[model samples]
Each structure stands twice: as C-alpha cells, then as structure tokens.
Target: MKKLFLSCLFLLFFAVAQAVPAKSFYFTTSDSVKLYVRIAGEGKPCLFVHGGPGSWPKIYYALGGDVTEQDMTMIYLDQRGSGRSGGDDKTDYSLNRMVKDFEELREHLGYSKWLVMAHSFGGTQATEYAYQHPASINGVILVASTLHLKSSLESYIVEGARILNKPESEFRKEGASVGETLGKVVSQLNEQDLMYKVMYPKKEMFAQMNAVMDTTLNWHFGSKVWDLHEYEQDFTQKSASVKVPVLVVAGKYDYSVGPQHYRLFKFPKATYKTMATGHCPYQEQPEEFGKYVRKFVARLN
Candidate 1:
C-alpha cells in the first residue's frame, strides 16, 4: 500500500510538470501604446492577427484556443487599443499604424520571419504588412478576409437583407428610403445579431458567439477606424503585390466579406478554400478549420 501511494504521487508530479503555461508580455508601440501579447504552444512560430479594426485577440481564442497540437508556436496579439492592450480613444488607430505595430511586434519578439494568420479585417492588415515587408513573412493565412473594405461592406448589406427575409431590391430601397449609411448599420451589429439571427443560428454556436461578443465589445472604439479606413481606401494593386505564400480560408455563408470577393484577390502564390459556414468559420467549425490550417502550415515547414 505504501509503495503504491508513492508511485501514484510520482506520476501525478510528472503530469503536473509536463503542463506548460503560456507566456504573456506587453510591448509598447512606436506611439507608446502598450499592447498585450500571449505566446502559447510550442514548435514553429505562427503569429495570429485577429479582426475588427477594434476587436480583441480573445475572439480567436474563443474560435480555437491554440494550435500547439499542430506544431505551432501560437502568437496571439491584441492590437493596440483592443483587449488587455492599453490605448485611448484619441490614439491613432489608422491602418498603416496598425500594420507598423505588427511589424514592430515581430521584431520585438526576436522572430526573423513567422507565418502570419489573420481573420476578418485582420486579413487586410496582414496583407498590407506582407506587401510592405515581404521578406519578414514566411507565409500568410487569410480567414474570411477582404481586399476592398467598401465592397465588402456593401456585400454584407445584401446578405443582411437576405437574412432578414427581404428581397435584395426591397432592402436597397429601404436603405435609400431611410438614408442609413453602411457604417451606421454595421457599427450597430452585435455578435448575437450577426451569429444567431443571421449566420449560424444553432444553439450550439450561441455560446461561441457570446464569447466573441463579450470580448469584442470591450474595445472602447469598436469599428471607428474600420469605417474611416473603408471610406477612403482601395486595395486592388496593393493586394496583388503580396508575393508570399498565401492561403485564404473563406466562408460560404459569409455575407459581410463574401467568399466571392476574396476570389478577386490576385496574389500570385495564393490558394483558396471555402469552408462550410458563415463569417466566423473559425469559430463555427474549429476542428475542420484547424485541419486546413495545419495542412497549410505543414507545407511551409
């Protein structure tokens, strides 16, 4: 009995020793904005750029916690002014500023080159980063991303109409009748409305939606930079210039940044795949999403 108890204690200690905690740190941006960074998992470095010009990094955690099992050193970064990162309402949340933050973060982390994984609006930022510093990127992964913000916003309006059970023509007429700007409509959308009412309506996905909403809505300046950038942006030539290995995972039911629009990207080394869900495919179908992600990164390895 004494021997057995000692053996059990030894095994338990071994198990506890094997568990690794994530490494957390904060890095200050050029403008002195301190951003939160979480380095989890082991193996090759893979930096995750989350969406929402203002969305936090936790949304990706809600989607799929870590890709460690796929042999990746997952770097989850909460962009400046979002999540645990420090930022004020008056801070410069411009697109170029955001891109520079990522570049600086990479250098600060001591990574020569790493795979960039982006989702939703993050895709645009990641693409821009790669375009500006192609040599610093090993590969690019775009999930439900868009090249043109204005066009993508317009697509969502069309999609929102369909989800509302109204004809496309009628929806457009109503928009004109009410004079509702695209930014006005989009800024008001919560995860509950976008996930349950429109896209993934199942009860199973509701919790995931809640997780996303809770974290995303905490960002004090939600969509403020997004709307401003879209109002004065076009990326046709810039997007085409991304010569790095690109993998775009789009959602079939995504109305916001429709899969069709992603198809318009002319990245010379790009490969596209449409997942079987809506805007938040990573959150909706994490298992399959991880599978595709693993395969894509495996090639880079």
Candidate 2:
C-alpha cells in the first residue's frame, strides 16, 4: 500500500515536471560523450559552468541562481561525466577538449556568441574556454574562482587547520603533492564537522548544500581534473591576455578558494567585487550579485 502510494507520488511529480514549459535535452560531443543541457529564460544567452570539477548546476539553480535569468538566457550544462551526463570511453578530460565542448555547443545552437559564468573549479575551465575561444564569447563572469588550485589548496590547509585547531604543519607537504596535502587537511576539517567554517558561515545553512547534492551523481571530473597537468598552469597569468570583458566576485570569508584570491587576477576589462559572504555569494548574497551581473550584462547588450 505504502509502496503503491509512493510510486503514485513519484509519477505525479514527473507528470508535473513534464507539464512545465521547460526545455532540456542531451547533446553528443565530438568525442561521442553525451552531456545534458537545459536552456531557459530570455534575452542574451549565458552559459553556466559549475564547480566541483564534477558538480552539477542544479543546486545553484535550485537556490535562486535563476536570478540572472531575468537579464539573460540561461544555458545550464552538466559537463561531461557530471550531473545527468554520460562519460567518454576514451577517458579524455583535457582542458582544450572541455573548452571545445562549449564551443561545439554554441555552434550547435547556432549562436554567434554567448556569455559564460563559471564558479569555483569550473572557473579554470571557463578561463581556458574564454581564452581559446574568445570569438565565441561576449563576456565572462567568474564567481569565487580559483585560477591556481595550489593556492586554493594551501588556503584549505591554513584556514581549515585553524578551524580544527590543528597545526598547519601537520598537513604540510614533505615532497607530497599539493593535491594530496589538500586532501589530508580537508579530510580533517570534514571529520571534525567543521567544513562549514572552511566554506560557509554556519552549519544549518551548510546543511542545505548537502541536502541538495546527493551521492547518485557522477564525479569523474573532480576525481581526475587535479592530476591533469594542463589544468595546473597559473591561469591568473593568462588572465592578462584574455580580452573578454570579465566580472569577478570574490568572498571575504571564503577560505575554500582563498577569500582575497581575486587580487591575483589580471583580466584587463574586468569589473571586480568582494562580497561579505563566503564562496557562494550568488546564493548567500543574491541581490548584490544580481545587481552587478545585470549591470554588466546590460552593457554587453
């Protein structure tokens, strides 16, 4: 009886979801990897590149991330081997290939150009995408991005160690890789139940993040991206060569990517802001985020 009732509820939910006037579908990349993409809203087109290397765009969009939709068409793409997306048999996750996927999607959609907004680790991919395919993008927006993962990992050791009341030297590198050191320190913070301190302001709100992100998703990009030598380059240095107009948002309390890391960026036509929130200023401080985003986007139109 209860099983039947639950099944009915699930069907009803699916029915309602289908009823909504939403557009979502899958696209096959040149490498034969299938990826999921959802297009909605109006005005200028803007692609959203999510973080976690493997993270999906759903949580952010679920958490009122659609605020930018008012001013632009939102293209929420789940990167290959990510949320609701299929993987490549060749196991290719190269930076150039990733950017090529974005370009191919643009050409597939028949768009001359679009804007791109990247978050956290996705910023690495977005930065590369903008540099290699500037002709296909009108502008780029980076939120709480880490151009240098090494810098971000060190931040986790320092800030997370401080929160756990552990000495940073305990996790310091002794010929170990930066990625390994980061894993050790971040594990400590998560074990102590102090991860919120490393990325959020409070436990309750942080719980909301976990509630939306579940274990059923694929995490291939996050699992393999760190070891990729191509991503290890200091994208901040390359920032100076990127001519795309940029909007950069940094957090005052975001130790995950280093709160003040934006200082290292050198995008020539960039507008910068430092929010009092943590790594997720878009969710924590949406109005302020929307204001600058809308203003910047308006200028592009």
Candidate 3:
C-alpha cells in the first residue's frame, strides 16, 4: 500500500511538471550564487530583465505570457538575491557582479545572441550588459528605463509634483520641514498613493499599478545593500558605444524616469514608442505593449 501511494504521488508530480510549458532551472553565477531561470516557447530567444534594483523577474510574467504566444522563446531570470535565487551576500549586487550574473546565465543557456528586454532599473542593467558584451546581444528593448539616475530622479520630483497639482516648491518645503530631501519624502509614500497623485495621475493607470506595486514593494524593501548603495559604475560614455538594434518604449506621464530622459541614449539603430501609461506599460496596456514588442522583433528579422 505504501509503495502504491508513493508511485501515484510521483506520477502526479510528473504530470504537473509536464503541464506547465516553461522549463525552470538554477544557473549558478561565478560567485556561486544560484539564480533561478525560466525558459518558455521556442524560436528567437529573448530575455526579460525586470526592474527594481531588487525586483525578481516573476513580475514580468504577465507580459511574458503574451510574448510567449509570439515567435520567440522567453527567458526570465530572478537576479541574485531577489527571487528563488540564492544570495547570502548582498554586496554581490554590484553592477559588475550583476552583469556577470546575466552574462553567465546566457552562456549557461547556450544562447549566442538574444534580444534584451528591460523595464525601469532593469534598463540600466540591460545597457550595462549590452555595452560589455555587444557580441552577445542582437537587440535591446527598454521600457521606461533610464540611463541617467540623478536626472531621472530630479525630473520625477519636478514633473511628478506638477502632475499632482502640487508645486515642486511646496514639496521641497514639506521635505525641509521634516529634515529630508524632496526625493526622500516622495519615496516614503506607498506606490498606490504616489501613483495616484503624481506618477500615473490617471484613474485607470493608477488602478492598474496596485498588483505591480504589491510585488515590487515587497522586493524593493527586502534588500539592504543594492537597495541603498549607489551603483559602482556610471556608463554614460559606454552607452554611446551601443550600436545594437534598440527599441525604447516610454510612458508619456511616467514620473519615475521622466519622458524626456529617453533622449539620453544615442543608439545608432533605434526606434521609439510612447505609451499613454505609467512605468509598467506592460501591465497597464498589455495589448499595445505586446504589439510594440512583436513589431520590433519582426523588424529585426
């Protein structure tokens, strides 16, 4: 009886595993950190690098699901210390180390050239990776990503306050009253509150940010090192060296990166698309987002 029950359990496990199309594995980095990776579909390979210095790739699943339906294989990875990946040393979150993790993952998966897709902070990561290993990247897709951090933050504060119908000076005054910078004051507010007031500013987009906020908030605050420390390298000069096919999708009202900051990159082969959403266009406007991706990938072929 015991043997029969064990056999049935084994069969159930196998069936469930087979039911899911995605194949998941652990890719160990040079520092021995085992990061989680998920691969689905089959065709041209494309990787999705999620935002949030500490965010996991799982949040991209909503968009990944749609991408998989197209003619491309989707790879999702939880950067070291973020998702199912193993990480005891937060110091490993440095830019070089993070880039190394991505490079090693691509080598481990046996892909020579793959399209890189990044959102928010992941945009910085994608650029770093492409700059370092140009031979390994076929194209890049940046969604509301920024190349200049300080400028982006400043724009967010100025434009964000304006959208909220609150003067930037007023926000500065409030922050000063609390002995904090305006940016710090803005950071303290929850995603929904901030999105409703300044970031998205539209009722529809604001409502859609809830799930994204819930997931990212948990990931963002979970880290101590990468979350607080500044990235070691500034790739402003290296950014100009990126000649890969680039597709930038920006949110017209995204307070995070500021729409104007999109001009910072000078990719030789580049295409730009503006959406009527906030930071997470894939979540707020999935259909349009998918269309943009499909068209970009198609043009590359």
Candidate 4:
C-alpha cells in the first residue's frame, strides 16, 4: 500500500511540473474552420490581430511582444485562411463573418472581454469587430493600421511609382479596377526589387520579415478584400462607437498604409504616436514600439 501511494504521488508531481501557464493550439470555429491560436505572457488578455487583410501572426510573435507581453496576456490568432489556419470550402471571408470569428474565439476562451490590437490592414477587421461587439473589448491598439483601404492603396501606387522612377498614371487604366492596377504595379515593383523601399526604411528589414514567414500560406483574404464593398467604407468614421480606450501607433514613412492615416480615425478615447520607421514599426523600432504599447496597455488595467 505504501509503495502504491508513493508511485501515484510521483506521477501527480510529474504532471504538475509539466503544466504550462498558457497554451499554443488550433481551435475549430463554429463554421468548422481551424485557426492557429496561441496564448502567451500574463495579466489581462489582449488579442494581437495581424494585418495583410491576409497576413499571419508569425513575424509579430517572433519579434514583438517582449515588453507589451509583460503587461498583458497576448493572444495571437491567425485568422481564417491566413497563416496556419484552414480555409472554409464556402470561401466566406465577409466582414460580418470575420467579426464573428473573433467573437467565437473569445467565447471559446471563456473571456468576457479582451484588448484587441491589430496592425496594417488588420485595422479594418479589428475596428469592425470592436464596433460590432463593444462589450467584449477592454481596449484597442492599432499599429501602423489603415482605416481607409482606398486611400492606402493609392499611397502604394504613388510610392511604388516614385521608387521605380515611373509615372503613377502608367499603372492606372480607365475603368480598370484599383485592385488590378495595384497588382500590376506591385508585380513590376517586385521585379525591380524596389517593393521593399515602400514597406521598410532600411530595405533589409523586409528580408527579415520574409525570413520568418511561411510562404505556403494561401493568403486568401488579400485578393478578396477589394471584392468586398463593405471593406471600402472609411473605417475611421466608425471608430467613435468602439467604446474602448485606443492606442494608435503610426509610422511616419510607412506608405504601405499611409502614414497620415491615423489622422482620420475618430476614436473618442485615443492615444496617438508616430514613429520614424516604415509600415512594420515593430521590427524597425522594436524597443520604442514595445514601450509605447506597454504604456498604453498598462493604462487600461
């Protein structure tokens, strides 16, 4: 009897010793889509929404959150059809559906509320989610986020033209879709190796971002963004209804999502800061980015 009790105690101790404070996993949504979700750090929960309308959370997880994570539990989620997530056969990437994904994740995690922070194109999805479900958010953080897709697309066209020494009008055709023109310009820019000029200040950092990414990701959300008219709406105008304190971090030279975009946001409670880097401020200026984000998150609790 004594030997059995000791054996049982040893097993229990081993299990307790291996326990983790947080988890890394893939959770299936109500629509039967699997999303890559990770829970890290401690304190209040903060959902880190990645941008690209189609990008993943990999780069941010690999480089950022060193300091901000110290203040809050950072929940990194790769949205449906992005990163390590699986896409649905119906191909429903609508605004309402994307917002519902966030809500369902929150429900699955059993959190009544959390802070939602997004970058680049993710501003659109995050803002819409917070607006549709204000009670589920404690605060919002937008890093180099674009609230107006059309204006940001124009910025890309103009900047890509200037870098390659070509006229912006060269890319645009009468009655052609903005998405089509943007694609042609982007293809030419990539061919000339000047695309990094618009996305990063040093140019080399763009390589750093690419290094950690999984090229296999389908990135289905990006190509479909222009097809959805709802995405064209000026998200800044709806910011006032979010009902949560917000932190807006902009990059002065980040033309990927116009540097001046932050000015258009109408958050009733907002804190704004503009950095000297490009679109991915978290990579170009990680320390300052972490500091600004940490301070903003600390104020919330």
Highest-lDDT candidate: 2
- Show model 1 residue runs off by greater than 4 Å: 1-18, 168-197, 201-203, 215-218, 221-223, 230-232
Model 2 lDDT, full chain set: 0.86
Candidate 3 stretches with Cα past 4 Å from truth are: 1-20, 63-65, 170-184, 187-194, 201-209, 212-236
Please give, for residues 1-301, the per-residue lDDT of candidate 3 as tens digits: 9999999999999887655487899887778877788887666888888777677675666533345346578898887767666776443566778888888888888998899988887887899899989999999999888876666767767765665566566667532532244445475444426546545646665564445444423342246543434542454556788988999999887877787778777887889999997776776677888899888888875
- Residue 178, model 3: Cα distance from true site in angstroms: 14
Candidate 4, superposed: residue stretches over 4 Å from native: 1-22
The TM-scores of all predictions, comma-separated, are: 0.83, 0.91, 0.80, 0.90
**Residue-by-residue lDDT tens digits, candidate 1, 1-301:** 9999999999999887666678899898889988889987766788888877677777776566454334678899888777788777778877778888888988998999999988787877788889889999989988888777777877777666655555556445442622254434443444326434334535467566565565434375454664454423656457788888898888887776765878778888988889878777767777888788788888984
Cα displacement (Å) at residue 2, model 3: 45
Q: What lDDT is obtained when candidate 1 is compared to the true structure?
A: 0.74
For model 3, what is the C-alpha lDDT against the true structure?
0.72
Full candidate order by lDDT, most accurate first: 2, 4, 1, 3
**RMSD list, candidates in order:** 3.9, 7.5, 7.2, 5.3
C-alpha local distance difference test of each model: 0.74, 0.86, 0.72, 0.86
TM-score leaderboard ranking: 2, 4, 1, 3
| Span of ten consecutive residues with least summed lDDT in model 2 | 14-23
Q: Which whole-number lDDT from 0 to 100 does residue 290 have in model 3?
A: 82
Error of 4 at 293 (Å): 1.1
> Which pairs clash in model 2?
none
User: Candidate 4: what lDDT?
Assistant: 0.86
Error of 1 at 266 (Å): 0.9
